[model samples]
Target: MKEKYLSTRRTYRESVRPHDGEVRFQVAVEQTDLLIVAQEDLRHEIASFVFQVRGEIKNWILFHPEFAESLSPVIVDDGAPEIIRAMAQAAALCDVGPMAAVAGAVAQAVGDFFSPRTPNILVENGGDTYLHSTRERVVALLAEPDSGAVVGLGIEAEAFPVAVCASSATIGHSLSLGAGDLVAVRAQDARLADAAATALCNMLRSEADIASVLERAQILAEFGVEGVFAQYNKKIAAWGNVELVALN
Candidate 1:
């Protein structure tokens, strides 16, 4: 797995800004760029949580460098922090490294911190997201080069608190062996979504690989993945309960 450096970008946060009465804010700390939305201004609280989670994860990484460096799944101790355990388990399920789930795990942590105080919350770390909304939410798909094209997701309000994480080989700093434009995964937790996205993208090198990859993605259902959406060479495909919508 490649661990390339990524800078904070506003394009994705701006593209997915919710119009459903939710307030949005951006927070950048280190390599984690977050787009947090809620019923009210909770930027301070969200930032605090993000910092705490990042601190814990950083400490864990310091103790276990292998967890951060391994490209393959690793077995972590039961005493690991909740975020670390979540990442480890998600990585194991997707057969990727724990770091692959870092963004989603962090997003989920922030979401969990505010889910009790508010019924509607969205925490996006990098491109991974943990969202809970009182109204239907539309998540835009902004893959590389095809930025102007209209492709997105129509997520129901009832499916609030779900994780929608994406990975790409053609873009972003994440390590992927394949050459897919994008791989999006929806699951009960952001960790699984993130890791699965990376794993799936690493498997898709061409449009012809879609069928087999989609077949393999079916097994992810057992790991709490609800659906998958992929774009490769301008071709799009979806599986499970994902509802594709056009933004333009």
Candidate 2:
């Protein structure tokens, strides 16, 4: 149910079945650790499919083995949106090497579980998250050292159910080249949020660029995320509705 990948932060995913319903929920969590509800058989099947997809993508990245690969040469194996998103996030984090893709892979794998089924699945891996419904807001904890126990902003809402992921150097177990306590990426693509979180974290240097990073996070949200929140010094900047503000 919980796993730490390649010497990085601890990643957790689980399939929970409601005792009274014919539905099972599989959740992939990072800081937020959010989940959605769906039919049991459907949800369980998606979770299993994504796990296998994660294994394949990790293997694919091994062949390319370069930071540039993260930006391009995207692995096109057919699986699910979540799986693809995770692979892309990993490719972007290639600068950190192959291990960078682990979180994204798991997150994406979890998200992909909702392929055709809409409005009942949600997955948040390290902050980058994706949801099928927006009835509720997803708030997540940002692993920031100075942004208080809950990063800059605890939870945010967006246009739809969404993807929000975070990266940190001084917090959590994940490795980062930057000093930011938290780098939040809120987007529709769980993988992009994963990559952006790493990318943004790498850019975190001081309070000066915090504004710019926030702007970038906001810009990312416009693409589909709806909201992107980045916090480093207790100054929190968020874009979009911040769909889920309770995951934290």
Q: Pick the TM-score winner.
A: 1
Residue 93, model 2: Cα distance from true site in angstroms: 12
Alpha-carbon error at 131 in model 1, in Å? 0.3
**lDDT: which candidate is best?**
1
lDDT of each: 0.82, 0.52
Give the TM-score of each candidate: 0.93, 0.62
Per-residue lDDT tens digits of candidate 2, residues 1-248?
Answer: 12222333333223122334435444442222334455345544554555566555555546645522443335444443444445554544333343455565565555555645644555544444555553444344544333324322233333444556777666667666777666666655565566667767766766576777766666554444445555565555555555334323
Model 1 misplaced regions, further than 4 Å: 1-8
Residue 142 lDDT in model 2? 44
List model 1 lDDT by residue over 95-169, tens digit each.
999999999998888888788887788887767888877888887776753354377778998887888898887
